[model samples]
Target: MAGGRKPCRAVTARLRRSVNRRPGTASPCPWPCTFYSVVAGHLDGGEEVKAAAIRDAREGAGITIAPENMRVVGVMHRRAGDERIDFFLVAERWTGGIVNAEPHKCDDLSWFDLDRLPENVIPYVRRAIESFHRGVWFDSFGWEE
Candidate 1:
């Protein structure tokens, strides 16, 4: 998805980027957040982007979907390091409905149980979710990091 058309930048929030506490203190990013990673071959990214997406997903936060493919992004960055895995999410595939922030960007959004996802899901997404349970988040370029 690559954030659709525009490039995404880190906000650098203390809560979001709490470079405080211990190295492995209570998990860095939030859970259950959504990311908009790319879906293709090859990998490209740094530790920062991966962290953002993982934190977003673990914290259960939702993100805006890109207009290009009509899907929301979700990063599956790992805190332990080595960019474990990254992934993307098609907004329409989840349950519930889309948010009202950007109508054109996203039409059908859903808050999936996160525990039980639907069939035909992207491979990388499945992997990310699997790692999330163990707190072993990884970074995958096109996966959704």
Candidate 2:
């Protein structure tokens, strides 16, 4: 949470597998940064958390994830020029092929092994993935002590 009364809320969809046997995660390119980042977007007015994750997955990744197959892995209160709460949810299953639903916004969409993620993932995204693997639930980023 931020200093404001209502901080913006966002959702990041982390896929456990994208129609592959290997355990992996997929994301879009973080434009201008050359780093990979998961499917994420701001929540709509009065949208539920998991519902937003499902919606973002479809809108950003061209996949449909059932609410029952998605689970909250982590939550981050981040401050990067703005304060926002990010929900990181992992989906064990999804239907349809994975594609870059927003080519204009993303250069490419690809999957990486969970144990061998690329070195150039977005900082907080990488942190969230690591935290998910480590079973940590809550984190704060971009805020100085």
Candidate 3:
């Protein structure tokens, strides 16, 4: 269930229908699009659901990088099935902003020294932070296909 290579069944279903199924069925993540949308409304029908992310940055501890100065440097594509991957670049710059919980997606957030991180930081994010310290690179490298 972890770490192997296979074509996306989702993409295959789009190109050739299964023998037992009809053709032209709409597949998820249809071709050539990385953007999707979901409709949301509050129970009161007066609110809109908005997706959000909690981002934090830390610098020092024998390191010269800063998440506050991060930038989108490159995006590597390896069409696993029907999705494109993204990677953001971070640089060293000083700034001050409290690491707080992500209102929606991230339930908690905090800044940790390179040697010490929050107990609940996502696994993938923790890996990326580690890679930064080792001078290796990781961005969605351990996620998805």
Top candidate, metric TM-score: 2
User: What TM-score fits each model?
Assistant: 0.32, 0.81, 0.35
lDDT of 2 by residue, 19-135 (tens): 111112232322334666777777787989899888988887788988999998889988876677888888888899888776666666777787788777777877887888888
**Of the pair 1 and 2, which is ahead by TM-score?**
2
After superposition, the stretches of candidate 1 with alpha carbons farther than 4 Å from their true spots are 1-98, 139-145
Question: Scored by CA lDDT, what does every candidate get?
Answer: 0.33, 0.72, 0.29
Q: What is candidate 3's lDDT per residue for 1-145, written digit by digit as tens?
A: 2576533311000000100111122323232222211111112223211110002222111122333443433333334344433343434453453332223322223233556654543343345456555655434443463
- Model 2 — which ten-residue stretch has the worst lDDT? 18-27
Deviating ranges (above 4 Å) for candidate 2? 1-5, 15-31
TM value for model 2: 0.81
What lDDT is obtained when candidate 3 is compared to the true structure? Answer: 0.29
Task: Give the least accurate 10-residue stretch of model 1, judged by summed lDDT.
Answer: 12-21
Between prediction 1 and prediction 3, the one with superior TM-score is 3
Model 3 TM-score is: 0.35
TM-score (C-alpha) between model 1 and the true structure? 0.32
Q: Which structure among the candidates has the greatest lDDT?
A: 2
Query: RMSD in angstroms, all models?
Result: 15.8, 5.4, 17.6
